[model samples]
Target: MLAKVLLLCCACAAALAAPGVYDAVGYAAPAYAAPAYAHAIAAPAVAHYAAPAYAAPVVKAVAAPVVHAEPIDPNPAYSFSYGVSDPHTGDQKDAAETLQNGVVHGSYSLVEPDGHLRRVTYTADKINGFNAVVERTGAAHGAAVAVAPVAKVVAPAPVAVAAPVARYTLPVAGHPWG
Candidate 1:
């Protein structure tokens, strides 16, 4: 009788353990007991993915230098014109003064006959600054030529003046003139 009682208890325990054994084998549990089964299983290990490697950059070829055929000018002449105006008042007062004084102020440069370059400066206050041309002749000297175009003036015809009007009046009944 004791052996039969022990066998009956073992049978009851086996019946209770059957559902958990089926769950461990991935069998679907009842909806109400799903949370308990999910908590019992171990999660899968996370994947460790890596990025792809890049190759080294390549260098491009360089182009060759260019060369010219013709010989360049060793002592070429350079010419330019510039006007001077009052910096404070923005008027060309110096130009009028230069015309009245017949003098000009400027700088010049030249290449000497012996291949040496020389520069000279001059200031002529009374000279007009109109149509002035400068030429770099050689390394020694430069020339300035003024070629202002002359303008002709025509006089207008004279107009006649009108005579003044005269006025006379009679003396009133006062003292001597009456």
Candidate 2:
């Protein structure tokens, strides 16, 4: 706490100075007896501290350098195709694919809500793994028409009228709230 208020203000300025106060060893603390000139005054050589010399820091060891990375392409080649004819939900479809060195050809088609046209075709590698083959063409045209999703008209936010303050009403002759 502020060193006890600076040691109570140096003990109230050494008790308002002067009462034979040469303390800390220069002994003249009288205020009573032994004031015989306090032994001719001469006691100031007590300094014994000694603690300031530094040097302890050294470390070294390094060895790190070995990197080799550049080899990727495990039969990686690609090709892609996509299609989507969504006449508001009539939702047609289409797809295509290809990978080279590892075989993976593909095909896709849709539109089969009694509207036929469902072609599919596929293939994979590692010596024949997957293979698809579905084909439906035309032939049922009489029940696919339910489109209805196009309505977004939001226009109604323009209103800020506040400009009419004319004044001229001096025809008073019996007004109650004219």
Candidate 3:
């Protein structure tokens, strides 16, 4: 048993020492050649480092700007509509809606490869009240509402409850025995 324990200790020490010795040898040499050892070090010394002759700077010709007489709208109404049509179940659903001001608003929907419908809605705040409802038959449903500002709510403080105390009682004998 003593010999076996010594053998195990030696095995663990060898395993721990192997990685340290291996890393020291693996990283000992540098990959790049030193500047003093390079043969091209003397080549640059023979060539003189001098600037070339100066030339006159050339000026680029500018073109005249063209102006249009027609006026264009800065904020154009962007309206788009899309829908998702499932190929497996043959169920079509609306996915997204986009609206810019009162002039334009649209919806879009798309069906994923796994028979899932994805919907999106985009609407401008120019309208008074806007509500969007997205429903997936059996998977998930969501709703969004835009309402006028309402009163703020404050929660009441919680009431504290007293903890119960454990009581112990000793039994009394009816008659004393000698």
- CA lDDT of each candidate? 0.51, 0.79, 0.56
Report lDDT (Cα) of residue 133, candidate 3: 46
Clashes per candidate (backbone, < 3 Å):
12, 0, 15
RMSD of each: 31.9, 17.0, 25.2
TM-score of each: 0.17, 0.29, 0.25
- TM-score, candidate number 2: 0.29
lDDT of 1 by residue, 71-176 (tens): 8765444334444455574332111212222445455554443434444444543343333344434442244444698999898988989889888888666677
Across residues 1-105, which tens digit of lDDT does each residue of candidate 3 receive? Answer: 999999999998898666334343343322334367546554233322233347889999998899878887766665444555666876676644444445444
In TM-score terms, candidate 3 sits at 0.25
Query: Native-vs-model 2 lDDT?
Result: 0.79
Give the worst 10-residue stretch by lDDT in candidate 2. 24-33
- Model 2 stretches astray by more than 4 angstroms: 1-42, 46-51, 55-67, 74-98, 102-104, 112-114, 118-136, 141-178
How far out, in Å, is residue 76 in model 2?
2.4
Q: Which window of 10 residues has the lowest lDDT sum in candidate 3?
A: 43-52
